[model samples]
Target: ADGARGLLAMRQAGARTIAQDEETCVVFGMPREAIELGAAEKVLPIEAIGIEALRMAGEPKEGIGSRGAA
Candidate 1:
């Protein structure tokens, strides 16, 4: 429950969360736990993860599109 509690605290503090997509994860342990615990708000690929996080962090952006899409 430690990780859950920490995530809960962050949520209470109005913080958003992003987890690297399972496809990009080496060990889908903590992130999987967090996702199952209702912690992560967004799960994105490694390349998109940073942009997603920045977007949630209130960064102004031109736009966001799935980079993997062609």
Candidate 2:
């Protein structure tokens, strides 16, 4: 709950925030809370989370078509 609130605050401060999707969670409490609080801009599966984060950070992903990719 506290972590969700912190993510909310970060979003309110204009940060790009993401939460893990419910289907992929072993414990959905935190991510569900964050989603309910409108903290996450994107809710993604666990496998894709790292790649999405890399994309958001402007890092190349070889053939993954992310930002800065050539």
Candidate 3:
């Protein structure tokens, strides 16, 4: 699948990566493949995904809060 392939390619290009755990995945095929291929650095459950991704994305490059009128 494209997700698995992309993960592999990204790893080959020196990028850290994460994948959803098989137990938490609706479609385990992709994540499973990525894990099997040694592309994923860690596999986390869906519930923890948001926080983990946010942490990785880092302290928001842009300023906090909305840009709309106060």
Candidate 4:
């Protein structure tokens, strides 16, 4: 709850966020809290977090786009 409160504060101040998915989390509790509080804009696997952040920041790496494209 405390973490969610802090994330909410940052969010209200125009901060963007990414969160770890339950399957990828050792203690899904905290991340789950922030997610339920609407603090995260994207929730993804731990492996994908960095890639997603880079993409969000407009600095994507080569050969990583649409990882599972049809």
Tens-place lDDT digits, model 1, residues 24-60? 8998887887787778777888899877776766753
Ranking by lDDT: 2, 4, 3, 1
Best by TM-score: 2
Output the worst ten-in-a-row residue range by lDDT, candidate 1. Answer: 59-68
* Model 4 residue pairs with clashes: none
Give each model's clash number.
0, 0, 0, 0
List lDDT for all candidates, in order: 0.72, 0.87, 0.81, 0.83
What TM-score does prediction 2 earn? 0.80
TM-score for predicted model 4 compared with the true structure: 0.76
Model 4 agreement with the true structure over 1-70: per-residue lDDT tens digits? 9988898888766666888999989999999999999998789999999998888778543444437656
* Candidate 3 per-residue lDDT over residues 24-56, each given as its tens digit: 898898889999998987799999888887886
Model 2 C-alpha lDDT per residue in residues 1-70, reported as the tens digit of each score: 9999999999887677889999999999999999999999899999999998888778533445435646
- Indicate the worst ten consecutive residues by lDDT in candidate 3: 57-66
Better of 1 and 3 by lDDT: 3
Among the numbered candidates, top lDDT falls to: 2
Q: Give the TM-score of candidate 3.
A: 0.70
Q: Which is superior by lDDT, 1 or 4?
A: 4
